[model samples]
Target: MEKKPSRSTEDRGISRARFLAGAAALGLAGAALPATGAQAAADTRTGRPGRGLTRRGVVYTVGAGETPGTAWDPARMRADIRAVRRDLHADTVDVTGDGVERLTATAAEAAERGLHVWLQPTLGDAPQREILEHLAECGRFAERLRRHGASVELSVGCEFWLFVPGIVPGETAQERIENLQTGTADPEQVQRRLTAFTARAAAVGRSVFDGRLSYAAAQDDEVDWTLFDVVGIDYYSYHQDPADYVRELRRYLRWGKPLAITEFGTCTYAGAPQAGGMGWSVVDYDKDPPEIKGGLVRSEHTQAAYLTDLLAVFESMGLYAAMAFEFLTADAPHLADDPLHDLDMASYAITKPVRDRPGDPASPWHWEPKEAFHALSRRYARAAC
Candidate 1:
């Protein structure tokens, strides 16, 4: 399988001084208690504090089967949610993937576990002519999940200029990624096309789905929030100043709608946090058989610390909701003890998994929990207390 290019919008590599500065900024007190899930704190479209609502959740990446060559197992998925609720103590889940069946099943189980659901069904490299076909699938999924009586928020799509076909100068996201990496794509045209499609998506989305709506945008655009409910941004930290990441983010809150960090997470490696979104790829995908770069070391701590600091930032800013980029990337599994074959070194999952092996017999999960898992559990559990 051809490895896709990086999803990061900027080079997130940070200085050691900055990392230490962030660590200092976050003292023990930040982790001692839960973030102010204040009833008076804003958590809705109007920016008014909803009664007891701070969307604490993880992005449940659709189904277990979807993870590279890992056999599809619905049983494993249900078991995973049980752990998400029990271990992470998350109250919300942004379920994302391709199939309608996978999206609904995950949402249904999450709801049963007493968690709010955010359904994001993708159109995946669909052509300009297939926009309607894309929305139809989304409409069907959103409307059905709405009927389930779950506290659900439907995200129309994410980073459309890159993911959706023919929206940008390139034909596919792979092409657009190349154009973006090389700085050849037209920014103004990308913005115009994105906002235009967004308006149409919001209007059509409102007609089919009888509930609140949102879109996980890439770069900022003039979205017709008048047509939708909440403002969702797929923002990540990759800038020099810690304040800059927040500075760019604060602009979105001005929309006067409840905002969500639709996606965020650091990969597991020694320098992953410092590298930000670009950190996890220690392997050179350019090779025929991708190999983990020599000298790169794995450190669950880097991943954990980054998540802790960012979550604290989110809590301090009083953001309504956020979901880690994913729960697990089973396809990016551990390839024996060799650093070159360590696939987990390339993933963002809080749980480290081995691809071509049976899971641990002692544990119900196929993968072992990384340090980030414990850190996440403490953060969410402390908040609840």
Candidate 2:
């Protein structure tokens, strides 16, 4: 990865003390605080305490194969959850799944093991109708889980910003409408859809039982704020200075809702070339090799450093929740099976290699805890107690 000169060192005479003083004057707390009105409303909707919710919960990025009785044996899955709970001293685990049944069952299992569960389901490339149907399905699923006496703390559409019509990689508003046959769809359409979805969920809660539902969105866009009870942002370690990334988060706080760092991890693929002729050569940050045709690939040590710095900022922010990007991945074959995988893909596998050769296993990419992980775990354990 081409090293951008660290912002921590500007040629200007300003020192770290001055910067800290400025940040303190800004009234930015990296961790929890008294709930604002919007945050209280969101907490009511989500069935979580608005204040003191930042027990520094663990966000486990679960894959399809790692579920109970699947790629991981039931015993192993339970044991892993137990181990994570013990290690992090955390009681909450966020899980992603395909549908309501799978997610509800997973949540129930975790709840049985004394863990609060958050269900995350990706609203795939389905059109508007299908998407609404899926939301209704989620409502029904939440009802069923409640009937079964399972306590699912939250139900959020995973990567929801990816599915918003006008947004996303390709497809314009006109194209999205033609595809949906729905009326002219814009950001308003996206917001309306989300509002209706959440409204229906709240209605279902009133009719049946109450459950929390929100959407997890990438922190990239300003318009995403209008859609949810609680705001969710995926904070990554792609930036040079983690503090800069946290500063960007202040804009989202304007929404006045409780915020969650729903997905956070240091990318291990820094040396990969920029995609689609973006015109950046990928170089290994560790080696600083001349730009090969590929773009910059991040090193494992850089990844750990990024996480540590970012987590410190998060700790100072007093946000509602911050979850690590992932826990583990299937073996390399499984990783290869993911079509999204490419040279530049950001994989959080703490156990994978950038190249076939033996890379830095001690790097943040390895499964073992690094200094950053220990620091975060200690912080979380302290906060939880």
Candidate 3:
């Protein structure tokens, strides 16, 4: 079957610095209730969890984590962490981006909030020197957080074959995906290259960051589990089958190391769980001013159920931690009747993005919490109880 060309993520001309400067004060304050088993996992005094490394987490991404030109809003980033901590009741947040400065700034913000930080600095197919440079800065971020008695972990990178150059014979992630599917890329060679670099990163990271360390691995990658403290996977459910999903998860148990889900979530569209991560491309771009191609209904309920079902698996399986794919997916503001163009439609964020409304004085972007937000909060509260 011929795969149709994908409708690329529409670039809404939001400048990075413009958004950064403009989006600083977008948070509504609220006190967070403690999370379940968080105290048991970290020290009560410093609020530094992860002596045992258990976590309830969400990936606080800026610009989908992979989109080029993604920048961070220091104030909004801090506020999002607070929202994740307070709103979601999640104890940890995986701050992901390819920008080293952005990642370090995020770690500082997370530290100030007394929240556990997973600094996942992405490597965007750069050279060895650049990769090492990013790793060194990440080490500094981790060390600084530790000095302040904050819990921090450095995920060297995620899914190297897709992100790093020279590991696979592709110029772009999409090309690599196609190469893998078409049997043009050698899987064994890719694994070897990825493993070699990962080992090097672990050594560099350990030299400075005397805290926990792991990588956000894709499940299919043949990695050496012995090198790290925790085994992380970007596991998403296509709802292939609940039984089969659990069976695949059980396969990780053979490694005997702790398991962490680094990413997972569905789009807000109806029947999204079945579509999985690709649920966002609801447009056929062959036509000028691409038209909405999906026939599915818009269903926040489907997204909520998808989240709960996966969390249920993690809870029953005694996995280390599961970070939802994200806290904020896109910075695009909502426009009425333009549902297809609304960036939040493709986002896994639990908050629906809205423009400035009357009576809300903090900022231009207003985030309306979704059902998953409340569900996660309640679940975390119950677990903590």
Candidate 4:
């Protein structure tokens, strides 16, 4: 993706900054509530929780799956971390990728920049033993960071039933999801398997990383909250109403843990808020160069509005943290030529990744911030102030 200068917040004219500032102030002024058992232990280790969504963050995937094109260049990785802190006013970052080395390097970069790190090593579809080993290795590295006074947490795994084999009947994630949807995968059995796996993962994490333990659960994942310090959910707003979010989120509070929305954001297109996490399905990969299915309109404002509105909901709900789904998606570059070929429309990233000209040897692929970037910049900057 070709890098470009970002537009200023003043130029974007986003109005949510003041709203966010006021909301944060109100939250801080509210009477302090008694800490839950999980929160109490966390407080003992890391001090009390702040007002609302104190860990403002974005999920930055350094490398995942087979996308070598998205691999992190050390210099570019540092630049992105700096932007998350300086430009977005984000105090936390959820660093996810495949390898231990890549994940550790990225987390260290964010920590060095004074941003809290959620070290999530995403080794999708690997053997259970391999995944456990991966988490243990990453946890050890995170322990080193914590000992050195860096604010860091280790997320053992994310949505393992879909990503990890043996839990479900199918070999691949798509197949497992399909089988589950078709009722071939028994829900009760799946829950039992997930709970058992989470217990083992938590044990491994606790043995190495003493900072904090979390797992990024799917919206419906019935995780055993007793295994974690912070209950993490990858929340996407399929419904627009705040009441809907409140109703759905109330269940998590029963666990008596500080809830963190580890992932939240929609693609850059009209009706993406309704599409939620599946908004990326609009692209037809069967084509030589994949194109959008059809008729979807590109609307940066829709993406911006959805994110800001959800941020308000998270803040009002007093979430411990809410990480926007992503900062950028290098594999899904923006193509200005045609609507059908514009892959950025399906990305949740605040920035539109653009590749260099076809034959330019000196031009490196880079990114330019979208309207959502400016909107979030305003809200997060004001909230921090």
CA-lDDT, candidates in order:
0.64, 0.46, 0.64, 0.74
> For this target, which candidate reaches the highest lDDT against the unseen true structure?
4
> By lDDT, highest first, what's the ranking?
4, 3, 1, 2
Task: State the lDDT of candidate 2 residue by residue for 1-385, as single tens digits.
Answer: 1223123222322221121122222221133223334543333333332234463555553334322222434444566567557785666677664455555555666777776666665444456556555556655666666667765645446433334343322242223323333334355665566555455444433443356555565444333445456677655323333344445666668878878777665444443111211112132223322123343334556545555555555655667777765554432211233322232233443334232322222222213443435555665576677
lDDT of 1 at 381: 87
Measured by TM-score, the strongest candidate is 4
* Model 3 regions lying over 4 Å from their true place: 1-53, 63-71, 240-243, 285-291, 331-336, 356-364
Number of colliding residue pairs in each model: 2, 28, 2, 8
RMSD (Cα, Å) for all candidates, in order, is 8.8, 12.9, 9.9, 10.9
Query: What is the RMSD, in Å, between candidate 4 and the native fold over all Cα?
Result: 10.9
Candidate 2 ranges beyond 4 A from true positions = 1-53, 61-76, 127-151, 164-209, 222-227, 237-243, 269-299, 331-346, 350-375
What value of lDDT does candidate 1 attain over all alpha carbons? 0.64
After TM-score superposition, the amount by which residue 67's alpha carbon in candidate 4 deviates from its true location, in angstroms, is 5.5
| Residue 265 displacement (Å), model 1 | 0.9
Worst lDDT 10-window in candidate 1? 24-33
Instruction: Give residue 286's error in model 1 in angstroms.
Output: 4.0
Ranking by TM-score: 4, 3, 1, 2
Evaluate residue 338 in candidate 4 and report its C-alpha lDDT on the 0 to 100 scale: 76
lDDT of 3 at 135: 80
lDDT of 1 by residue, 66-143 (tens): 223454468888988998999888888888766666767777888788888888766555565476555667676767
